[model samples]
Target: MPDRWDCVRENTEWVCKSTVVANTKEAIIILTAKEIGPEDSLAAYESHLKTPRMVPDAQGRPQKSVIKSVVSRKIAQHTWLDGLQLGSEIPSYYTRYLATVKSRLAILVTFSAHQRYFTKYSGDFFKAVNSLRIVANSDLLNPSATSSLELGGSEQIGPGQVPGFGSPLQVPDLDTLPSEPSGAPRNQQLLFLIGIIIAVAGIFIFLKRK
Candidate 1:
């Protein structure tokens, strides 16, 4: 894989595929992983952005703006993700997320194309980040060919991917899901007749014995 500093992580690789990438408002999105540092919070990294940074802009020189960040949440020592909004008026946003799972604080940083774009796409981004699971014991640094590649997680199939029991899986009744087969006639009527025949035969046997 290409070792682009802005897109790849040291321990794990991410698939940040999207259908949106353009010069338009918040059109480009990028994700990169770095070693979790003492600054586990998003605001913790604002000092780094104090210096002016520039990006390629076909229109003109890259806009220089004071980078300001907002911490979405910080749970003492549990899980937290902070958002950064760069640029003025029409802005750009970045999401910095960290989770302390079993003494390991995995870090993920995102660069949003635009603040407006980030807000529009934040829902999916939050969903993706919140669902992250890391296997601290497994060989995440290097996996065999048979090893399944997924975002660091413990969920076998994810939030709504189990049989009859995911966020998206709700069965109100037997009719909601296919048991034996779909559109197949049930044998309840035949079974009821058979049950009645057995009951009548048992009654006759009891009277004969009496």
Candidate 2:
């Protein structure tokens, strides 16, 4: 076996394979020890092996054993795999389990990307995922302060301005007006009335004389 060969054992059967290849970027490798029994003849042929080598005979012919093991050795090379140590009372397949979870999450997030089904809640969920990513990389809860709540726009009002539900501005009280009079000056009003009366009186006198 090559130095890069990862070993997996299941049910007394061991197979050596590479967990991953840097140049090829392949993550899985399948190896066949040998072929046995008529049931696995096709698999044996596919593996380019003639007869089963590791296992012994059953009642009559050798029983074909099908064993599957993950490529753990090469998987350990990945940084993500370092958290998933095998056989330490913790789950032995944490790496594979997390990969499955991430895959499912990606699919769900992708499906939610369609516009028709994406509501405000969906947007919130997407934002939450983004926040998680930011939290993983940074110390701040909010990565951008400008992206906070909007202020002073068409959708918002100035400070101390209460929005009216049914009217543009609240109606003012009748007594709330200033005590000072707002009409013309008192002398100007008297002069205007006097001018009107004199004009009428002059017209009447002229008619009587005529």
Candidate 3:
């Protein structure tokens, strides 16, 4: 997680928001993990891309989800969609669904925001996604296993760790995923905050000298 994001645990879900853009409630990211069985498959989720189900928009009008694209890599699948269409008076709602499996563990991450404000905070969202890592420790592969994250980046579970239970489920076989987005900014808000504090201190020092 980015240092500038506020994250909280709600049962099995981790809800996160960019501190700088916290005012926009739609600027959020949610992550959940669970053990899967042989019956669960990525194909089941892909079916929705072919045939979308209607969902209510902000105005309470029914609209079908718009499929943007699908990206797949070894043990991972990505789906981008516009959940709500852009209207004359309402902004379009966008969401990215990312599912990854390793052994018996399946992880799902959802990133969402209104189209009007997505670009402003997209860097943080993508960074969070790219940072995810799967731990191979044996202790984490059981039903009673638990994990926690620290605030700083040095901790093993702080930034890129995924939380979940273990299973004997089977996952889809796929080729290697493409490289992550290299251009995304990291800890941007933290740097910006530091700059502001320095400027304020400089001004205060000048006034004190006067």
Candidate 4:
């Protein structure tokens, strides 16, 4: 965890929040792990990524969820999703989902930030995500073989040395963010906080299907 960031672990998920930003505009990152079964294959993940999605807005109205980008790396599949309304707290949000399977362990790293601040803090978010490593048991056969997901390659940061909290995660400019009807400053932090919660929940829900 980075300085000024607090994390809580529940079963297979870890949710971390940055406190450097105001409470109204915080940033969040979630890491989740699952035990993969024989049926869970990388091809399934790719298909899911290519599928279109419809998300419910704050008013309970359905809206199209857009996949901004998708990348299939040797060891990991990365997807960027945007234009999803996560309820009143987060009228609009952005998410980067990095999925990989290593040693029969399926891992998903999710980073969420207010659409307006995502760009600013993305560096730290990705650094933390890429720093995660799974050490396969040496006794297992085919020790030389690696997982299909290539989650490594970034400069690693040591324990208790997570990326700093001073940056944003590549959010759009404030002007581009939706404002309240009354013209009051929106509570952007809630968007990030809620995004983390929904993301963790969604991960478990989806993993159960694998």
TM-score of candidate 1 relative to the true fold: 0.38
Q: Least accurate stretch of 10 residues (summed lDDT) in model 3?
A: 150-159
lDDT of 1 by residue, 1-210 (tens): 111111222223232334444333332223223223344334443333343444323344565544454345543233444434343212132323232322222344343333334545554444444433432322122211122211112222111221112121111212111111122223232223223333333343345545
Candidate 4 stretches greater than 4 Å from native? 74-91, 138-210
TM-score for candidate 4, residues paired by index? 0.56
Which 10-residue window of candidate 1 scores lowest in summed lDDT? 173-182
RMSD of each: 24.5, 44.2, 17.2, 13.2
Q: Model 1, residue 111: what's the lDDT?
A: 30
> Model 3 over residues 1-210: C-alpha lDDT tens digits?
677777666554566676765264546666654544443356644443345445544456666555555555432133322122121112244556665544444455566655555565667766765554444333334433323221111221121222221111122322222122456544444333323333333343345545
**Can you give the lDDT of residue 77 in candidate 1?**
31
Alpha carbon lDDT of each predicted model: 0.32, 0.21, 0.44, 0.46
Superposed by TM-score, candidate 1 places the C-alpha of residue 163 at a distance from the truth, in angstroms, of 36
Candidate 3 — what's its lDDT?
0.44
**Regarding lDDT, does 2 or 4 come out ahead?**
4
TM-scores across all candidates?
0.38, 0.15, 0.57, 0.56
Ranking by lDDT: 4, 3, 1, 2
Question: Which residue runs of candidate 1 sit more than 4 Å off their true CA positions?
Answer: 1-12, 19-31, 34-46, 49-56, 59-62, 66-68, 75-77, 87-106, 138-210
Return the top candidate by lDDT: 4
Runs off by more than 4 Å, candidate 3: 74-91, 139-182, 185-210
Candidate achieving higher TM-score, 2 or 4: 4
Superposed by TM-score, candidate 1 places the C-alpha of residue 74 at a distance from the truth, in angstroms, of: 3.8
